[model samples]
Target chain A: MRTRHPFTLLTLAAALPTLAWLLPAPAGALGTAAVAFGLAAAAGVRRVLVPAVVTAAPFWLFLFVLHDLPTTLAIGLRITTMVAGFVWLAAVLAPDRLVEAMVARGWSVTVAYVFAATLSAVPLFRARARRIVEAQRCRGLSPRGSVAKRLRALRALALPLLLSALHEVDERALALETRGLRSGARRTPLAPPPDPALERAARWALLLVCIAALVGRLV
Target chain B: MNPLTLEGVEFHYPATEAPALRDVSLAVAAGEIVALVGKVGAGASTLLLVAADLAPRITGGRLTGTVRRRARSGIVLPTPWTQLSGMAFTVWDEVAFGPANLGWPGREIARHVERALERLEIAALAERDPATLSGGEVQRVILAGILAMDPDVVLLDEPTAELDPAGARALWRLVRVLAGEGKAIVVATSDLDAVPAVADRVAWLEQGAVRAMGAPDLLAEEATCEAGLGTTVAGVWRAAGLAAPYPLTVADAIQRWR
Candidate 1:
C-alpha cells in the first residue's frame, strides 16, 4: 500500500468522497465510509485511522448540536467519509512523489513546484507558530484573560510569525533562483517515483467506479 | 572575468532611511576564500547577499554600484531551516534539490548530490529525514544543498553558527576544499579563531562598510582589535603586552613564544 503511486492513492481517496456525496444517503454513506476506513487501514491504520476518526468526530458533534439526529446522521456520515478519505490520502501520498509524478508526466515544473511548496508551507508555518507561542509564553505574555487580552496575546503570537513568514518570501525567491528555477526552465526529476501499469489501472478503476455509481443512481 | 567584483556599491533597503551597505568595494578571485567579520548589524550578511546577487534583486533594496560577477553563485543564508526545501524526505533528496532545479541530467544530478553529501561528511545521513535532523546536521545539509549546485562562487552567512566545535572544524575544512577546487567562496561569520586557518583574506566590516580588508593577519592589527574584530590569540597577546605584531592564531602565538 505504501508503494502505491501517489496519484493512484489520490484518485481512490477523491473517488470515495465523490461517490459518497452523489449516492443515496444512509446506506450509501455507510458503505462509502467503510471503504474510506478500509483505505485508511491500508495506509497504516495506527497513523491514519485514529487521526481521521478524531478529526471527523467534531463535525459529527457540531452537526448533532445544530440539527435533529436523522439529518445529522446523513450529513455527518457524508462529511466523515470526505474527511477520512483526505486524511488517509495525506498519510500515504507524499507531496514530493506527487510532484515527481506530475513533472514526469509532462506537467509544468512550476505547477508541480507550486503544488509541493504550498503543501509543505503548512508544516513550516506550523512549526514557526509553535516556536513563537513558546517564546511569547516565556516573556510573561498571559494567554488566558479577557477577550481583549486574549486578542492581544493572539496578536503577539501571530504578529511575529506573519512578519517573518512574509520576509521569508524574498529568501525563498533567492533560494529558488539559485536552484535555477527561472521561467521556462525544465526540471529534472531524480528518482521519480515509479508509476507502474498496475497503479495506472487502479486509478482508472477508481474513476470508473465513481462514474458507475453516479449513473446507477441517476437511472 | 574575475569571480566577483564590487565597486563603490551602496545599498538601502526599501522603506528604510539609512543604507544597509555603504561604499563597499571588493573583489574575489577564483580559488580564494574571503571572510567577512564585524559586530552585530555590521552588514556582513548583507555584503554576502549582495555578492550572491540576491540583495537588490530579491531583497528589494536600492543599490548603486558597478557589480560584476563572472560565474554562477549560490548562497547558504544564516538560518538553514528557512532555506530548506521542506518537500524533501531524505538528506539525499535535500542535497539533490538544487541540482535537480537546474535541469541537469539525472546522472549528473546524482553525481553532484553524492559528491556533496560526501564532501559535507553527511553520507551516513543520506537516508535520514531532514526534518528530524539536529541543528548541526541541518547546517551541514544546507551546505551540501548549495555545494551540489556546483556553482562557481559560494556565499555563506554564518554557516557554522549552529555547529558544535567539531562540526565547525569540519565545515572550515570543507570551505578550504571548495576554494581548492577553484570555487570562489565568501563567508560572513563570528568565528574568529577559524579564519586564520581557512580564509585567505579577511574583510572587517563596520557600519555597512568595509573598514579594513587585508591578509588573514589583518585580524591581528591594532585598529581591527579596537573594533573587537581581532582574533582571540591577538587579543590575549596584546593584553599581555607581549609584542607589537601579535599573532593571528594559536600556532603563530606558539611560534612567537618559542
Candidate 2:
C-alpha cells in the first residue's frame, strides 16, 4: 500500500473528505470516516489511528457542548475523516517520492522543493522545539507550577525557537541557492515512482465521483 | 582563467552599517586549495559566500565589488542539518538531490550519486534516513550531496565542525583529492593543524578584511601566532621560548629539533 504512487494516495485521501462534505450528513460522513479510519488502521494504529482519534476527540467534546447529539456526530465524523485521511497520507507517502513524481511531471524544481519542505517541516521544528525546552530546563527555567508560571516558561522556550527558526530560513535559502535550486529550473527525477495506468484511472474516477456528488447535492 | 575571483569585494548585509567583507581580492585557479583562517566573525564564511556568488543575491546584501564565477559552484554550509535539501528521505536520495537539480539524465545522476557516496565513505549509510544519522554522518552526507553536483568551484564553510578527528582527517584528504581533480576549492576552517598539510595557500582575515595572504608557512609567523591563529605546534614552540621561525607542523618541529 505504501508503494502506491504518491498521487494516487493523495487523490484518495483528498476525495474521501470531499465526498463526506459534499454528500449527506450522517450516513455519508460515517461511511467516509469508516474508510478513512480503515486506511489509517492499515497504515498503523499506534502511529496514525490513535493520533487521529485523539485529535478529533477534542472537537467532538467542543461540538457536543455547543450543539445537539446528531449535529455533533455529523460534523465530528466529517472532521475525523479529514484528519484521518491526512494523517494516513502523511504516514504512507514519502516526501522524496512525491518530489520525484512532481519533477517527473515537469513541475518546477522550486515548486517540488517547497512542497516537500512543507511536508517535512513539522517534525524538524518539533525536534528543535524539544531541544529548546531541554536547554531552558538546563538553564533552570522551570516549566512547572501555576498556569501563569508555565505560560511564562512556555514564552521563554518559544522565543528562542522562533528566532532561531527565522534565522534557519535565511540559512536554508543560501543552501538551496548554492545547490542550484533556482526558480523554474528543470530537474531529472532520479527514481520516479512508477505511476501505473490503473492508478491514473483510479485518480480520475475519484475526481469524477466527487464532481458528481457535488453536482447532485446542488441540483 | 581562474574559476572564481573576487576583486576588491565588499559586502554589507541588509540594513547593516558595517560591511561583512571589506576589500577582499582573491582568485582561485583550477586544482588549487585555498584555506581561509581567522577568528570567529572575521568574515571567512562571508568571503566564501561571495566567492560562491551568493551574497547580495540570495542573501539580499549590498555589494560593491566585482565577483566572477566562471563555472558551477556548490557550498557546504557550516551547519549540516540546516543545509539539508529537506526533500530527501534516504541518504542516497539526499546526496542525489543536487545532481538531479542539474537536470542530468537518470543514469548520469545515479553514477554521480553513487560515486559521491563512495568518495565520502558513506556507502554503508546510503539506505539510512538522513535525519536519523549522527552529526558527523550528516556532515559527510551533506558534503557528498554537494560533491555529486560536480561543481567546478567548491566552497566549504567549516565543513568539519561536526566531524570527529578521523572524519575531519578524511575530509581534508578528500579536499586534496578534489583539488587534484581540477576543482578550485575554498575552505574556511579553524583546524590549523590540518591547514599546513592540506592548503596550498592561506588567507588570514581580521575584522572583515584580508589582513595577510601567503604560503602555509605564514601560520608560523609571529603576528599570526600573536593573533592566536597560528598552528598548535607553532604556539607550543613559542610558548616554550623557542627561537624565531616556528615550525607549522609536528614533523617540521621534529626536523628542527634534530
Candidate 3:
C-alpha cells in the first residue's frame, strides 16, 4: 500500500473546479496568471514566476481594459487555482511514481510510460533551452538585442535544441529498451510509493466530491 | 573474456553517400580502458554507438559485420543534458534512474547511487535539481547515472566534452578507477592529452574506419601525422621539429625537457 504525495496533488485537484465556478470571465485571465505563478511556486520553480507573470501581463492588461473588476478577479482566481493544482502535482509527484501508480491501477505499462515521458519532457526541454542560450551567449550572441535580433538568437537556440532533442529520442528509446520497458512483461517496480489507507480514502473522497459538484452544477 | 569485439564493422547512415564507419575492428579486454580519438565526425561517436548496440538497433541505418559485447553495456552520450532522466527532480533521483529501471531493490539502488555520486564528487549536489546544474556538473551527473547501473562494459561518447579542466581531470580519474575495478571502458574523446594517462590503448578512427590502433604512443607517430589524425600534442611536437619518441602529454614533454 504505497501512497505518493497524496496531500499535494489531492489539494490541487480539489481546488480547480471550485475556482473555475467562482471566477468571472474577465478576471479569469488574471486568475490564470496567478494560478501559473502559484503552481510554479508550488513546483519549486519559483524562478519561472517572473517570466510567467511577464508573459501574461499583456493578456491581463487586455482583460482589465475590456472587463469589469469582479469578472476579472474571478477569472484570475480560477486560472491561479488550476495552475497551482498542476504545479503542486508536478512538484511532489515523481513521474516514475505516477507511472507506477497508473500501472498498479491496471493501466498498460506502455500507456503509463507515455504519460510519464510527457510529464518529464517539459523540464528536459527547459534544461536544453538553457544550454543552447548559454552556448549562443558564449559565441557572442547578445541576450539583450533588438526584437528582430533577439528573435534570430532565439531561432539559433531552437534549432540546436530541437535537433538535440530528436537525436536524444533515439538514445532514450535504446535506454528504455535496455531497462526492460518492453511490452508483455510484468515489470517489477523498484520502490512503489506507500499506499496508506487514509490516502486511498482521501483520493476516493476527493474524486466523489468532484463528481458530485459537476453533477450538481449541471442539474 | 574480451568485453567488446568489433570486427570489420561498416555503417551507412540513411541518405548519406559516404559510410559513417568502415571496416573498423577493435577489442577491449576486461578491465581495460581504450580511448578513441580523431577530429569531430571522424566516426568515433558512431563506433561507440555500434559497440553499445544502438547504431543499427536504434538509428536507422545499414550496418555490416559483427559487433559483440561480452558484458552488459551502458552508454553515456556526448550531450549530458539530453541523457538526463527528466522524471527526476533531485540529482539523487536522476542518478538512480538507470538502476531503478533495472528493478534493483531500493537498498541496492541507494547503495550504488551513493557510491556513484561519491565517485563523481557530486554527493553534495545530490538533493539539488538536475535541471539546474551547470554544464560540467550535468556531465558528471550523467556519468553518475550510467555508472550506477554497474555495467561491466561502459561506452562514453565525448564524456568530457562539456567539462572544464578540473572536471575533465576528475572524470579521467574516475575512468581509471572504473577500469581498476574491472570495467571495460571505451571513451570517444577529443581530449587526447589526457588519453595517455587514462587509456591503456588508443584507437584512431578516420572517416569511420580504424586508421591506427595500439598504445598511446600510436597517437604520436609519423603515420598518425601523415594520416592527418595526429593529436594536438603530437602535432605541436611535430611542428617543433621533434624526432621519434615524441611525447604524448604535458608530463611526457616535461620529462623530455630534462
Candidate 4:
C-alpha cells in the first residue's frame, strides 16, 4: 500500500506537456475539448466540469465578446483538462506514497515533507472551514442571507479559519521538530514501496511517448 | 541517577514584563513520577517545557541558570490534535512517526509501535484514521506516539485535561505503568485527586516558583487545603479535623482505615 501505482502519476505528469503541444493551433480547439472530456471521464472527474464551467464563465464571456471561438474553446478545454488531471492525481495519490516516491527518488526529506504537507492542506483547510462555519452558525450568524450579509458572514468565517491556521503554524513547527525533521538526518521509511520493474518500464515508456507526441506536433 | 535537574532556573518570555518561571529548583530521579500541580498561569507548563528542553529551544524565552535532562526526553503537549501527523491516514502511521524519524530499523519501529499501542490499550485503533477519532481517542493515540519513541524521560502537560473521569483514570494508570518500567515521568496537571496515586512526589508551583515540594501529603496541608489544591481525600480528612499529616487519596484512606 505504501508503493504507488507509478503509471498513474507519471501519466498525469506527461499529460500536461501533451496538452500544451496538441492544443497549440486554433483548429485544434475541438481536439482539446475531446481530450479534456476523455481525460475527465477516465479520471472519474466528470462531476468537476460543472464547477469548472462555472468558474470559467467570465473567461468564456470575455472570449465570446472578442469573437474568438477557437481561443475561447481552447482556453476553456485546457483549464478543465489540467484541473481534472491534477484533481484526479490528488485523489488517487496517497500522501504517504507521494512522500515515499519523492524520498526514494533522492529528493530531500524537507522537499518530500513540503509536498506531503501541501497535499494534506486541502483536508486540513476543509475541516477548519467547517468548524468555523458551524461555530459561527451556533453564534447566530445566519447562512441564508442577502448577498452583502452572506459576504459578511463569509468574511467572518475566513477570519477565524485564517487566524487558527496561523496560530497552528507555530505548533506545527514544534511538532515537526519533535518528530526529528532536522537536516543531515537519514529518515527511515517505515513502509518503503516495492518497485516492480514492469511498472517502472511502463512509466518510462509513458514519459517517452508523451515527449515524442509533443515533438511530433512541434515539427 | 536524577533524570532531570533544575538549579535556580528562571525564565522570562521574550517580550513579557515578568518572568514565567522564577528560581525553580527540583530533581527527578529515574523510575520516579513527579507531578507539578498549580493553577492556570502558575508556570507549571513553563517548568515542564524547560525540563523537556523545549522552552528556550522551541519557544522563544530567556533563560537563567541551568536546566538539565540526563536522558532523551519526549513531551506530550496538552492538545493531542496538534501533535497529529497530518500526512498519516491511519493511527499506526501516526504512532510510527517518531520512531521513523529516529531512523530506527523497520522491525524495531514496528515492535515499538505495537508495544505502545498495546500499552495504551488502543491496539484496536491501530488502523483507524487519527482525524476521525474523538478527543479521548486522539489523546491516547498521541500518548502512544510518544511511548513508541521510547524516550527515557517523558513530560506531559495537562495530558488528561480534556478527558472525562474514566479516561483520565486510564491515562494515569498508563503513567504509573511507564514509571514502573523505569521511565522518568514528569507531568503538569490540575487533577489533584489522581496525583497522589500516580506520582511518587509532588511539586506545588505558585506564581512561577516552587512553593512546596514533598510527598503527596504536602498537598494535604492546611495551606494547600485553603488554596484549593487539596485532593478530595485530603479535604475529607481536613473536614474531619484530622492532624496535619493525612491521606491524600481514597486508597490511602482505605489502608489508613484498616
Model 3 Cα displacement at A135 (Å)? 12
Candidate 1 accuracy as TM-score: 0.90
Interface RMSD of each: 1.5, 0.9, 2.8, 1.4
- Report chain A TM-scores, every model: 0.87, 0.85, 0.64, 0.65
Sort all candidates by TM-score, best to worst: 2, 1, 4, 3
Ranking by lDDT: 2, 1, 4, 3
* Pick by DockQ: 2 or 3, better one: 2
Worst 10 residues of 1 chain B by lDDT: B80-89
- Inter-residue clash pairs, candidate 4: none
Error in Å for residue B12 of model 3: 1.5
Model 4: residue B254 alpha-carbon error in angstroms: 5.8
Question: lDDT score, residue A141, model 1?
Answer: 82
Per-residue lDDT tens digits for candidate 3, residues B82-147, read 666565668987788777666677789899999999999999999898868898899899888888
- Please identify which of the two predictions, 3 or 4, would achieve the higher DockQ against the true structure: 4
State candidate 2's TM-score. Answer: 0.92
Worst 10 residues of 3 chain B by lDDT: B80-89
**Residues forming the 10-long window of minimal summed lDDT in candidate 1 chain A:** A176-185
Worst 10 residues of 2 chain A by lDDT: A135-144
The candidate, 1 or 4, that scores higher on TM-score is: 1
Candidate 3 per-residue lDDT over residues A1-219, each given as its tens digit:
113544436555555546466334545435544555666664455544444445445655776888987766665455555555554554565566666556555555567667767776876578768887788789998869699988887888798878877878877776665444566555435445567787667767766756675676577
Each model's fraction of native contacts: 0.62, 0.84, 0.28, 0.46
Interface DockQ of each model:
0.63, 0.79, 0.29, 0.58
lDDT of 1 by residue, A1-219 (tens): 667787888788888889888888888899999989888877776899999999999998889889998889889889989998999887888777888888777677778777877887887689878888888778998757799989978887888888988888877777776666665667787767888888888888888888999899899
